[model samples]
Target chain A: MSEFEPKIVAYCCDFCAFAAADLAGAMRLQYPPNVRIIRLPCTGKVDAIHLMKAFEQGADGVFVAGCLEGQCHYLEGNLRARKRVAYAKRLLAEVQIEPERIDMFNLSSAMGGRFAEIVKEMTQRIKEMGPANTDRRQQPVES
Target chain B: MIVADRKPLEEILDSIKDYKKIMLMGCGGCVTICFSGGVKAVELLASQIKIARKKQGKPIEIIECTPERQCEFEFIDAFKKDLESAEAVLSIACGVGVQTMSERHEDTITIPGQNTKFMGYPVEHALWEERCAGCGNCVLEWTGGICPIARCAKKLLNGPCGGSSNGVCEVDKDTDCVWQLIYDRLKKLNKLENLMVVRQPKDWRTSTDAGQRRVKFEEAML
Candidate 1:
């Protein structure tokens, strides 16, 4: 059987993680191609519904990458993003999905290597969890 | 506002497990103000249920709608087309909205997604506390706007009952003794005499225990 290539969606803040991803390309850093990046004006715009919709649409994993904690370019967007990410994680957990399937990370635009590392880390995590919805099909019915 | 709490997701999922599609309704009235039933809540719940169903390999479809007031037939009647297509309805509004939908559409199965908690107001940013019992009587004039029927542990009319300690209810240490609040407010207003005039028992018929209550305005009848 072929290995499961989990699909990861990364919501990146334009001021930090998005630029960091760009920088990773410029640095010739090799990371898994499994993750797709969606650049947002600010991570604060990352609503819990948006994250769940991604999972509902078929994302194996999702993560929000924003400015390093106190360094949000828009002054508290990342903070709000972090709180929303935590709330989304709790919601996902209630649906029997792994809380680890969604996450939030902090990075500087200059930290291209860290950005690449986050992607690889997320990819690894999803691979371990298997695909979000499909994995249920493999289990025996409890009832 | 009528404050309510979303039923746990597991309970909500179980109620509509038999349906393949449903109209997930939200109210733009009191439940919206309380954050239990609103457009934002409806969207999040729909996505959560969809993802949960997908995980079980039984993907259910959902149609999200938020009316200005689900408890009003006129607003709900606007989406009769969607109503006819959906197999069931999962309402995130307060109890009144749920009952209203079921009453209007007798053929469609309507399920509640929240537990209507109380007639209350936001006590803080995200906290709501029961402020009124809807007892159909106005006792606030003498009680300084705090209702013992709703806020007090014993529902005592004139009391600092022995259970009140350090200005907090013994029922729950976190709750302030309503009688204490009344006394302080009345003392501030120099109307402590109102507390001394309690000579008769309250009419219990005004409360819910008597039966379902209704009001009709003869002049408003068409």
Candidate 2:
């Protein structure tokens, strides 16, 4: 059997988490190559529905990296993100998915090492859990 | 608005476990306002169910649709084609909407996805309390705009039952005694006299106890 390579998705906020990822690369901070980073204007823009879609599209693990709780660039965006992430976790748990398969993190824009660390952490966690069941028998959603 | 809550995922999954494909229907009326059934809810639930089925290795297909008001036959009629195509329908509308679809489209099986909770509004961000019992009588005129039938723990009409402690109902510590609220409201409006009226036992016949109720408009009838 081939070794499993988990597919992890990180939703990073533009003002902080995304910048932190950029800095991680600039500073040559090595991280797992399995993560797919998608940047949004603010973590507040992330909704439970978006997280569901990420899993539906075959994500083995997902995390939202945002600004430190009290320091959202848009004031309370990270707080809203926190609530949505929590809600999404509950939804996932209800459906027999590991709630830990999803997570949220807070970091400063300058935390390049931390950004790399989160990616590696997520990759390691998902590897232990193996891949999420992507063998869906669902028909394509009619446009 | 009529507030509702979605049924747990496991029960919903079990009910439609036989179907290979289904239409996930949503209501754009009260359930939408309550954040239980709406376009967004439909999308979220569809993804959840799909993911669950995939994990079980018996995946199902879903088509999502939300009509303006599922209780109205006309709105449900518009989706007849899709309804006929799916093996079954999972409706997230309140009970009324689910019945309307089933009654009008007898050929399709429509399964309810929500429990109709109450006729109420959001007190705060996601908190809703039953406000009106639909008793077919308006007591708000004298009670200072509060209905004891719905808000009261014991549905008391006279005054605060001794069970209340610190203005909160002993039946539920999280809930404020509605009678206390009625008293405060009437006092602020200088209408505390309204509480003093000796009220007779309510006639329960006017409520749903009379059976399935209907309101007809003669002039509007074809």
Candidate 3:
């Protein structure tokens, strides 16, 4: 049987994760291509709606990558983003969705290798869990 | 202003478990000022509901709308058009707003998304303490601005009970003794002599005990 390729969405801070991804490319550090990145100005700006929407839009896993603690470009943007991520996890668990599918990572702008590692780890985890069975993407309507 | 807090997300989601199309109605009056039933709260509830319903394999449709004020008929009238397609409404206003919505739209079931606490003002950000009971009596002349009915642990009209110790109430060490507060405030305003004059017991009939208070203004009336 062919392995399932989990669709992962990564909401990345433009100043850190996005920059690190670009630097990874320059450094020729290879990572799984299954992860699609969405650049956000600050992690704080990413609302709970965005994470839910990504899942609704067929993302098997969603991850938010922000700057290291106390290094947020917009003061406490990363801290706020951390709080939102924690809240989203609890909310996801209430709906029977495995909170593990959603993850938050903290890394500096220079840690290209850590960013790549997170993508691989998240992709592997989602592959084991299989596809999401959320209300927006149910398998089939039972007759 | 009235104070309230948002109902738990689980309770709200459970209330509309069978409904497919839901409208989150926010009030921009007291609830808005208290950060419980404002636009931000409506948006938060909407997001939580959508995420929750999605996990349950139910494709629920949620629409967010905020009325200028949910306590009045005219203010709630603005939501009639938006209610055309919604199966139910989750009102994030105070008790008055919830009743108003139910009265205006008898056919649509209105669920309260907040717990109406009391008529009080914000003491700090997101923190509100009861200040008045609306007893239809103003006793500030004797007790200063501190309301014994609302602030006193025992609601003592005469003076502080024996529970007061060092200006703090024994019922709650964090709370300042209402009588002590009254004394300090009265002393500051040079009204300490008024405290010595014993006032008669309050007339409960004129207060909420009268049952359903009403007010009419001759100048405002046609």
Worst 10 residues of 1 chain B by lDDT: B197-206
DockQ score of candidate 1?
Answer: 0.59
Error of 2 at A81 (Å): 1.1
Candidate 1, residues A70-112: lDDT per residue as tens digits?
A: 8987899999999999999989999998999999999999999
Report the Cα RMSD per candidate: 3.9, 3.1, 3.7
The candidate, 2 or 3, that scores higher on lDDT is 2
Supply the global lDDT for candidate 2.
Answer: 0.90
Any idea what lDDT model 1 has?
0.90
Best by TM-score: 1
For candidate 2, lDDT tens digit of each residue in B1-222?
999999999999999999999999999999999889999999999999999998898989998999999999888888888777799889999999999988987888999999999999888988887889899877899899988999886778889988978889998888888898999999999998888898999888789888988899999999
TM-score of each: 0.95, 0.94, 0.86
| Candidate 3 lDDT by residue in tens digits, A1-143 | 76777788999999999898888888899898888899999999988768866776677899999999999989999898887888778766766678999998998889999888999999999989987765334353222
- C-alpha lDDT of residue B167 in model 2: 86
Pairs in clash, predicted candidate 1:
none
Please list the residue runs of candidate 2 whose C-alpha ends up more than 4 Å from where it truly belongs after superposition.
Answer: A136-143
Q: Where does model 2 sit among the CAPRI classes? A: medium
Supply the global lDDT for candidate 3: 0.85
